[model samples]
Target: MSDEPDETPRLDVPVGMFEDIEDLKSQLAQLTALVEARTGGDSAETVEAVSADEEEPAGGDAEGEEEEWQYPPFILLLDPPEYDDELRGLIEWVEGVLVPGYLGEPSADAKWCHRWFEHSVAIARLHAAWLAWQELTNPVSCGNTGPSVWHRDHLDPALRELRGAAGPFAGCTKGEHRVEHRLPSLVPSAWTHEDGA
Candidate 1:
């Protein structure tokens, strides 16, 4: 092993170093943005070079420039305003990218709800798919096979469930929007309550 001045830098980022999922997600998002901004192309695969000291500056800039909402864009967790803001972005991707690029013909058997946001399950699942798309499509993290992996692992299952007969859009048709789509019933509580104490 001849050491002729090794160039590639490395760091040992501790597992579970963050306080919560939000913090981890925030750091990752910041890192990805910084890499994208600096590199300008999809070649920055050496994420280990980012020193712990350098981490804060990236995150600091993100706080001022980007949205404060660091958590996963889960539909239910967000307030009305945040929901509206996030949903708008999600819809843009869904319409511009997912629907046009990914989806095939929608038929009676393979359904798609016109009013998808109204259905909670669809919103949740689609949001998850969008999130996966964002991450997997990024070249820095996933490389060339990212989209393929996303299609196989994320998109396929999501679409299968979403477009299937028993999916959230089961009642809806190609031309007609179902007025009311009922959610699956929850299992009743097994514990029995005694007389008022």
Candidate 2:
């Protein structure tokens, strides 16, 4: 239940449900492929034909691929700038800059994407809350910013409530602490001391 004006409903999801299903499917497929590769006993001509079938389609156009090999990276664009050139620049940077920045060589079939995406959602939400705190709380670093002798100082209690309602997934230890530590660094502040003493 957010107080924000938007009426979008939030959907809670399990972390490992998709991963488990995918792992089972991958294992079964690989096992079947290994059995066929061993039992078929390919001759030189058969191997050449299989290799040709594995190659890019006859048209030589890389854009559209056949159903047999279809694992393309998605280019998702969130609200881009007003200029068309800038949008094209964003797409180019995603392809040239960001994709190549990752270490190790990767082909279209074996990109290092899913490995980096598991905990990304949690980090994104935590960053959003941190940004909200930074904007709303004056005295961003340290000073009499957040608690100016007036407004009901329920910030800490409110944070505690927010932590509890987030519905942390199973096997996640100290999710609240991870969220709380984003507020302040290694120094004691007004929020650290109890009773505002």
Model 1 stretches astray by more than 4 angstroms: 1-69, 184-197
Q: Global CA lDDT of candidate 2, please? A: 0.41
Which pairs clash in model 2? none
lDDT by residue (tens digit), candidate 2, 68-106 = 343221122222343344345444533453346532453
The TM-score obtained by model 1 is 0.59
Each prediction's total of clashing residue pairs, residues at least 3 apart in sequence or on different chains, is 0, 0
Q: Which of the numbered candidates is closest to the native, going by highest TM-score?
A: 1
Q: Which lDDT tens digits does candidate 1 get at residues 151-186?
A: 899899999998998888888887777736665466
What's the CA error at residue 42 for candidate 1, in Å? Answer: 18
